[model samples]
Target chain A: MHDDLYLALRQCIIDGDPEQAIELCQRALAAGIAALDAINEGLVPGLNHVGEQFAQGEMFLPDLVMAGEAMKAATAILEPAMQKAGARRETLGKVVLGTVQGDIHEIGKTLVGTMLSASGFEVHDLGVDVPFETFAVKARELNADVVGVSALLTTTMTGQKNVVEALERHGLRPRVKIVVGGAPVTRSWGEEIGADGYGEDALAAVALAKTLLGK
Target chain B: MQPKLEILERELIERILGEAFTLIAEPGVKVQAPAAVELLAGAGARIEEGVAHIPEALARRALASAPREFFLHNRAGEAVVRYGGDAVQFDPGSSCVHILDPATLEHRMTQAADLVRLVQVAEMLPQYAAQSTAVVCNDVPKETGDLYRLFLVLLHSSKPIVTGAFAAHSVPVMIELLAADSGGREALRRKPRAVFDVCPSPPLHWSEFAGQNLADLARAGVPAEVVSVPLAGAAAPVTLAGTLVQHAAECISGIVIHQLAQPGAPVVWGGAPAIFDMRSGITAMGAVETAMLNVACAQVGKHLGLPTHGYLTGSDAKVMDAQAGMESGVAALMGALGGINMISGAGMLDSLACHSAEKLVLDAETIAMAQRVLQGIRPRGESLALAMFAQAGLRGEFLKLAETRKLFRSEQHLPSSVIDRGSLHAWEQSGAKDTFARARERVAELLAAYRRPALAAEVEGELKAIVGEQARRAGMEQLPGLGT
Candidate 1:
């Protein structure tokens, strides 16, 4: 019976069903379920399954968007109770995610965010077209474990290094774990920009973040 | 559709083919790598002093046995396309990232969910033919990218898939996937729709993995595509002619290997060759040199009577702006005119590294326009305006004539939104939007309109069980969401 609920929740997310997902999540929360219990038991497994199916080509974008919203909704509900219980989720680490300045491509960032969240980390998505200042300010404000910046184009790849350079200028370089992603980013590039790590794809990014946090 | 090129104009095509031939005949292409050289030497191709020149006669003999057209079946077990005529085939190319938020430049691992969305989008659009570019996992540890993409495409759509099996070791698993699933072995073997792409690394080489894949694909009765990726200034000589010679040598050598493995099995004359930008040291997909290499080489491939393939239709333009449209549009146009039978790399951006969801929608629009262009002009009977104009009398406006409405839709390739046409009042009423915003809205609408497809209860169970086994083996004790 619970497996059905679990499958439904995942399907709802992959379908991008925020409203229905909210209702389902609310029900689970009302049932006095452990917040971590719900996440570990229901949400994480669900998204991961969707992701696997997605990788297998069984699911796609609507499913991804649906899954993201469902994840967001479930996480929103899970966070309050976990905080009350003094049971902060044992995350792989914290990641500050953002798209670089003058560019609004966020699919890479969102995928990284979803993967990070599923991997058990707190991700502060700074939305799109974020300047280097926004990332530095937020990393400080949120106390990010890693600041991951993504840029899709060759022209905007410079924006990736700009964030790292900004952290340096602000004298916050040592404190932050800087990572770069998107299509144009390579390990060589990450080295060139003095970023701590670089991920060619989402799966690699998770491993990179985990390693940086010493998790 | 445009009238067929006249027999008189066929001479021009012959000239183009002859030009490609002259280069290959003279100053024979340099063959690098022992695997390719040995393979060519084994298959009756002439090789001397490390220079491999596949005689035109041999190319013809190989193509004589090559199948001109084939069909790929969809999920419902229906053949969805007849791969001939002016039909343009699109498939998911090898990509590392699927642009989820193009505006934010955010990407996620192209997971199963992304594959599902891509399949839906590809199905709805007129451009795509095959079901893949599906990467198997976003988080799984073991699966490599090429194999992963293949697995995902297999699961998501019933459409015949277009995939390149990477790293020779994965071939067994891939063959199992194509053969082992719900369908029995004969059903799997008989269908033979997954046309595997085998690349000969430039200046002329096939790694053991690719050589092995060619043998495996052919022995299994599946068709083969001889793919070459010669980056000018890096892989081949910087000249277009030099690249074409290298591309020909690569194909001829590949054909020899493929046919040697299993005689008369199909093979494509395929390449994704491009130029390395001198400024950034990056491979430039948008450069005119890149377009010329693809087009000119395609002519050579056709000259050998082989079904040609090129990984064109991809753009590196960062944003979904004018640059994206112009770059993708011109490249797609050239690819179409060059008589490329299968053009992969749709929905790709940033020089085939990143793929954009929004751009996929926009690129579909551009492909629609290119398809219309290839249609050319029709000089059909009454279709010519002579009779209509005679009836309408002098000074009659064609716009006001009754035949205008009757023939306009047929004559004029009407675009479904993404190309807006509205009077000022109607335009203002409908939200005065440019192409990108309108594209944004279209993407949202398509996404919103999507209904999650229900897999068979049994298939869903199998998929879940497979994932569960992996997670549990990875040492997660309590299954996620199981008790909830």
Candidate 2:
């Protein structure tokens, strides 16, 4: 019976229904199921499935975002219960994402943020026209595991390199990884700028974050 | 020769108009300009906060006052480009920040030299009736960029320019520069040397800057090409027809203000409408649906007997590849066949983010091909080559005859040396260059052959002085040095 409930919870996450996923979590707990089992067996597996499909090109950003929302809602409900039972919820990693300074392109960075969150990483989207200092400050504040910088113009692509230097200047580079992607950005550019990884698109970005975490 | 591609039925068009007016009356258009709000409110429009609920009749009346056709005259004071009556003219796309460097095949920020080279190429091409302030020169201050681009084009070519003013204050300054070229304000108004493209923000919003520019263009007697950009599935409805209604309403709102500011001024039924690619979330200007929207909207504009324009002959490809050729060629043909008056946005790549002079040369060929297609079959006096048939009678000796010599030039579009029509042996001997390489060579040849049109020394001095004054106003000591 609990297995069937866990399956329902997984479907709710896949369907991207945060409300339904939270209600399912409540029903599972009311049925005397362990909160850890609900998260590890249901929500985590569900998000992992979404991430795999995204990496395999079977799912897109919108679907991944919905599933991420569902997982977040389910986790919000389960974390308190897990704490009461002397356990804590696990995460893949934390990510800080934004379009670099002087570039206001929103779509690419937001897509990567959504995919990272869906892949079980806690993503903080700093939004467009973000200053270089802010990326470093946010990474330090959130204790972020990865910083993903995006730039759509060649004129502003240098800002991405400056972001890497900023993180290094703040002494956060040793602990946190850096990933860069945009229309004009390439893998060689990422390497030349001392970034840990580079992605051509959102799926590759999610995979890069996962690899950085050794997941 | 006029060719049209019609999509909406008569009843469907009527229904669309009804729906459009209903949309305007309910949610109305958001007019951010206080003067525009007052202007509409005084003209029987019901104003609720920022939105102006225009009556259907008021919009139709504005449409009536707009000229059915207007001409953009060259420096020679001749009507070279018609903005009505199934005329088709193309100009290179505008305001791209980067140029695809032909030497290195890399995209870089456009400089003063790049813009001058672009203007020279466009000036040499007979296919381009007018020139545009195509690439934004990064060397110039952003405040004075628009007028400086206009200055560069006017100095390099005698052609009429399709330019825009970024800030409302710059509109009059650009107009003054054009007046200096045209001799005076009266001469400029009588035969305007340039048309300013004034745009409105999409999804039923016109900001105060655009509003002021429209009114200024109207009162100054300079033509205002109202470019309404609607991004479907984001700012507009997902369906094409639904998007068309919103486009019509937005254009209608612009017309009302433009005509109210000065009745019987020249205003184009122009827009750059494209589908929002849901996956990429970028405005897909190269999408077939984007071309379809242009054709359909122009058709509606023609139905209303208004001058029409569309953004076409552009591609989303990052380079001048097969995708660029396919997208640019197909859209150019569609706009021509649909009888759009002025089709802008050629020679653009990476979704209009970059410009290429080589692509401009290639697109000139594409436009020439589309123009050939629109010419249709010219029946030769009902003879159907009977005179030639009587002499040859399938003997296949026509190539040796006088009629063949007389007819071949008229019948065939013998492309320039830019297009490779040679045999394999000849091709191999020419270093086996690709289309892009050939285009680069052609670009070099065109620039080498370009002769700057002579202008009056005083007028040239006046234009330079105006640029210098504008630059100083923007906190620059002088204008950027003009490059060769």
Candidate 3:
């Protein structure tokens, strides 16, 4: 019976049915299954399968985003229960992401946040046209392990360097890794701005985040 | 007699425009400039927190006043590029940061010398009707880079330029540079030698600088080409029709602002729309869907009887290979058949980040082929080849006939040596060069054959003084040598 419940929970997430996934999580918790077990044995495996299918070309961005939504919904339901039982879920790292000032381009930065969240990194997306002070404030507040800056236009790309300076002003450099990305952000530009890494796209961003954290 | 292509039917275009009008009035467009907001508000648009809900009637009034066509003139005062109807012209893609290195096949930061070389190559090719301020000069300070590029194009080529300004303040300075070349501001306005491209941020938002540029160009009587870039599935709706509605909304709002600033100002409905690649998270400029969007967008523009422009003939490949050829060639033909007035993006690669001089030469050949295709099938004589068949008879010796010799040149497009046609043995005997290799050699020959057009001594001195003064303001003591 427990095995059947777990299978149903995993299938719901794979199907991208957020409401069904949440119901399954609630049912599992009421039936004496551990909250951590529901997340580990059900939600994580479903997200992992979606990732694998995405890599193999069997799925697309909308599919991946839907599955991420399901995972997030199911996890949210189980989080309070896990906290009541003194449980903690393992995460890769905490990342603060945003598009820099003077650029209101949102899609590229949003994609990075979604991919990082789906990959088990705790993401704090500050949204578009973010001020430099907000980035520094969020990094200090969240105790972020990594901060990713995105700028789509060449005119706004210099804002990435200003972001680096903002983080340094708050004395968050050296300990926190900075990864810059967007259509115009290049490896050399990242290095020139004193960023630790640069990602060509969202996938490269996830991989670079892992390497930065030594995962 | 031109072979035309249409992507959107008449009914569909009406429906799209209807939706676009509703969008601007309901969700409204975000206007960052206070003056633009005031202009729209004074014109009866509801202003609620910097967003203008423009009514369809206001947009129609603006459209009615907008000029249907405009001409870009050369230094000799000849109207060379027409931005109306089915007249198609091409220029290299503008403002790329990198130039593809011929020796290493790598992309390097483009400098002033690189921009000069690109202008010279474009000046010699009759296939390119106008020159573009094609590449960014990394050698200059960022503040003055826009004017520096225009200065180089004016010195090297007498062709009318397709260019843009990055900052709002630079618009007037760039215009001043053009005026100095054409004798004065009034003369430059009478025969406009350049068109400035001003783009709106996607999903119905115009940045402050972009809004200022539209007004500045309108008041100055210079042409402003609105390049609306809607990245499908990212900044815009994923479906092609949905994106078209968004494009129309953005462009109509721009026209309203431009015409309000100056009634009867000229504007071109231009775009660089692309599909956002889901797998790679990149804007796929080379995709067939992107071409479809451009063709459909221009059809909507033509529906309103306005001048149109598009970005095509670009490749996503990092190198000059078969993928580059297929992508660039297919889109060039599509843009031509769709009757885009001014097609930009030849010599662009890596999703429009890099420019290649060799690729520029090769694209000229592709442009030549597209122009030939535009001249649809026509009967040369009264018999439509029947008389020629009567002369040849069963002997099949049309090669010996005088009519054949007289008509073949007009009938066929004789491509340059860049396109290989000789036998395999002959190709192998002459170093077995591929298209890229042949293109590199062609670049050298064209550069060697290039002679700079002479300008009036007084006008030339004035041009230098304007550029030099701007350079000093940006902390540069001297302008980079043009190697003239």
| Candidate number achieving the greatest DockQ relative to the actual structure | 3
The positional error of residue A12 in candidate 2, measured at the CA in angstroms, is 3.7
Evaluated on CA atoms against the true complex, candidate 1 attains a DockQ of 0.05
Per-residue alpha-carbon lDDT of candidate 2 for residues B326-356, written as tens digits (9 for 90 to 100): 9999999999998888898988998767899
Candidate order (lDDT): 3, 2, 1
In model 2, pairs of residues that clash are: none
True contacts kept of each: 0.10, 0.10, 0.45
Query: In candidate 3, what are the lDDT values of residues B1-484, reduced to their tens digit?
Result: 8999898999999999999999999999999977788789899999998889999999999989999999999999889999999999999999998999988998988889999999999998999999999988888888999999999999998998999998989999999999888778898888999999999999899789999999999988889999999999988999999999999999999999999999998899999988988887778989999999999999999999999999999999998899999999999999999999999999999997999999999899999999999988898888986788899988989999899899888888999889999999999999999999999999999999999899888888888898888888899977884677
The best candidate in terms of lDDT: 3
lDDT of 1 at B354: 63
Off by over 4 Å in 2: A16-56, A61-113, A119-215
Better of 2 and 3 by DockQ: 3
Query: Which scores better on DockQ, 1 or 2?
Result: 2
Error of 1 at B228 (Å): 0.6
Better of 1 and 3 by TM-score: 3
Q: What's model 1's lDDT at B175? A: 64
Quick one: ranking by TM-score, best first?
A: 3, 2, 1
User: What TM-score, computed on C-alpha atoms, does each candidate reach?
Assistant: 0.62, 0.85, 0.97
Computed on C-alpha atoms, the DockQ of candidate 3 is: 0.58
